[model samples]
Target: MILTLLDRLNRRRAWLRWGLLAAGLLVAFGLPWTLYPPVATDIVCWGLFAVAFDLLLGHAGLLSFGHAAFWGTSAYGTGLIAIHSGVPFYVAVLGGTAAAAMLALPIGYLAVRRSGIYFAMITLAFAQMVYFVTNQWRDVTGGENGLQGIPRTLPGFDLSNSFVFYYAALPVVLLGLLAAWRIVHSPFGRVLAAARENPARVRALGYPADHYKLVIFVISAFLAGLAGGLYAVNHGFASLQEVYWTTSGKVAMMTILGGIGTLWGSLVGAAAIVRLEDWLATAGFEATGLVTGVIFIAVVLIFRRGIWGTITHLLRARAVAPVPQIEPHLEHDHDELQPTPTN
Candidate 1:
């Protein structure tokens, strides 16, 4: 009976999962019509960026403060390719993403050797180095002004239209989300999670924990790069701010506000933060950061699990919670059958 109950519960959870995914996709598809296409595009780009950060911080227990290095690098790489080489949109994006991954390779190798705050600091230092390089290479990077006049020319599609661009970006963002989902659900992801929980144990069990960390770090950087590449095309510019430390901080906030380990929650957080900032700007509030800070504080204090995380917790508790138990009676029933002693 217990096994039967468990099976039914599992099936119900599966249905719920599919239903939620369908609803989410529906909202995503319909959002451009409801809101400005440009705004929606920003949400998608930032959402992907946040999700990439979460893969390292949430699942792998690695907190990186230099994620913007990957993001900005890819943005510049894509923008430059689009401007100078005149490559196809897809090729430019791929080249940018590949560059980010390559940059991550050596950095991740060194960063993974350390853990905790040391790891984060190492990444941040490297990111600062990258920032300095980009800032000084004025001839190539456009320095403070940034790369401009980037053409959004996807093959066979007129991407100058905001509506058309939004649709074009949608599939790429969805694929990034899908890739994240697959990573978290796969056996490698399980091992990664195990490593996160207890690296010493994972190491003792013949697994190289550092190797796993480095691999995941590279993958996360690649996704961030992909988002950055898309953003460059979407905005027709790649700015130094994209690689700045503040951008990394903003993505960290998005990941935390959305619910750390919940991948989709990153999107929710991104939407909340992006819309909040836009609303604040529209309202002529110069102290936008103060209001955003207050909201972050409230979320951290009131909903410790974050917006979507709290909702998920409630749903799970309601769905599979056990019934209340009764206390055992002290006295035995006289009519109950007793077994005879064996010879």
Candidate 2:
């Protein structure tokens, strides 16, 4: 009977997962109609970035304060390739992502040797160094002026139109999300989760926990680079702002606010943040930082586990909630054998 009840709950969970996925896709399809094209595209980029960051921080139990290094590197790499090679923008995006992964390999190798704040500091230090180099390399990177005139062409097709570009990017974003989901649900992902919960136990079981951390760090960089490349393509420029420390901070904040390890929560957090920022800007709010901080605090306080996290927690609780304990009198069935007691 207990086994039967568990099976029913599992099936219910599967259906709920599919239903949520369908609902998300439906809402995403209608987003552009409700918001500006460029704004919609920004949301998609940030959403992908958040998911990538969460994979490493939330799942692998690594906190990085220099993710913007990968993001900026990809932006620069993508722009340079598009400017010179004149290839399809997606090709340039891939090239840029490769560059980010290569950079991550050495950095992650060193950083993964440490944990907690040490790990974060190591990544941050390397990222700052990269930022300095990029800033000084004015001719190649365009430095303060930024890398401009990057084309958004797809052979004979023009993606110069913001509306058209949003549609083009939407599918790619969905594919990235799907890939992240698969990564989380696979055997490898199970190992990652175990490692996160108890690295010592995972190591004792003969798993190379350190190697996994390095690998996921690189993987996270690759995915983040994809987001950065697309962002550059959308704007037709790569700027210093991409490599700034605050860029990393913002993504980190969004991931935490959404719920540390929940991948879809990143999307919810990203949407909340991006929309809030956009609204603040449009309303002529000069003190954007203060207002955004207040909003973030408000959301965090209200949705303790994060907006999506709290919602899912409730749903998960409801799905497998414990059966109520019945009083001894009610425990007896109409036809069940019961001991006769003398009053």
Candidate 3:
């Protein structure tokens, strides 16, 4: 009976996970009906971006403050290809992801040397350097004026329609999520997780810990770049703002708020942050900074496990706990019955 109950629970948990995934996809594809399609697209892009950062920060246990470099680089790369070279939208995005990964190689080499706060500072400095170059390089980056008039979608597709763009963005986000999930669950990912928990132990195991860190850094950058490219295509432009240190900080916050180690938590965090920002904008609240800061602190204090992480932990605990499956068998033998049988 205990085994039977356990099997039923395992099936239920599996079904629940699948159901949640289906619901998420459905909402991504259908949400444009109620909300402006662009908004949903933006949320998806940012969510993916945050998740990418979470890979390094949460899984790899490296906190970088310069992830905006990849984000802005991809946005600009794809936007330029779409606007100037007339490359296919998908191709442009691919180019952007590649560019970000290539850029991460050199940066990750040096940044991975340090750990904790110093590592973050190094990334921040590098990101600021990128921001400065973009702001100064008028010919390619258009200076502070930013890139404009990036063509959206393919020539045949009606990109202006929010629903169309939402659909277009959906697949990209899904692919990015899949890649991140694969990396986190793989054997190499296990090593990285070990490195995060104990770098010395990972190194003692004969793994070149720095190499693993670099690989994940590059992967994270690539995913982040993909999201940025999507953002550029969806928005029809890329800007200096993408490279700003604050952008990196924002992604960090999203990761933390969503539950750093939890993959989908980043998405939940991004949605909450974006929606809050939108509501504040609609309400003409000029003090959004104060409001957001307060919420960030509150969430950290109240939901340390993060919104998604906390809920997931609770569900997992419930799923794993044993359930009462059978009542005890009660036996009663009467002497009168025995005498009747003897007769």
Q: Is candidate 1 or 3 superior in TM-score?
A: 1
**Model 2 residue pairs with clashes:** none
Candidate 2 deviant stretches above 4 angstroms: 323-343
Q: Highest TM-score among the candidates is held by which one?
A: 1
* Candidate 3 regions with alpha-carbon error over 4 angstroms: 1-9, 322-343
Per-residue lDDT for 159-267 in model 1, tens only?
A: 8998888998899899999999999999999999999988988999999999999999999999999999999988999999998998898899999999999989999
User: Model 3, range 120-183, lDDT digits (tens) per residue?
Assistant: 9999999999999989989988988899988875777777876887887789889999999999
What is the Cα-based lDDT of residue 343 in candidate 2?
Answer: 24
lDDT of 2 by residue, 104-201 (tens): 99999999989999999999999999899889999999999999999897987778899888888888788888888899898889999999998998
Reference-based lDDT, each prediction: 0.91, 0.90, 0.89
TM-score of each: 0.93, 0.92, 0.90
Output the lDDT of residue 5, model 3.
78
Query: What C-alpha lDDT, on a 0 to 100 scale, does residue 325 get in candidate 1?
Result: 46
Q: Pick the candidate with the highest lDDT.
A: 1
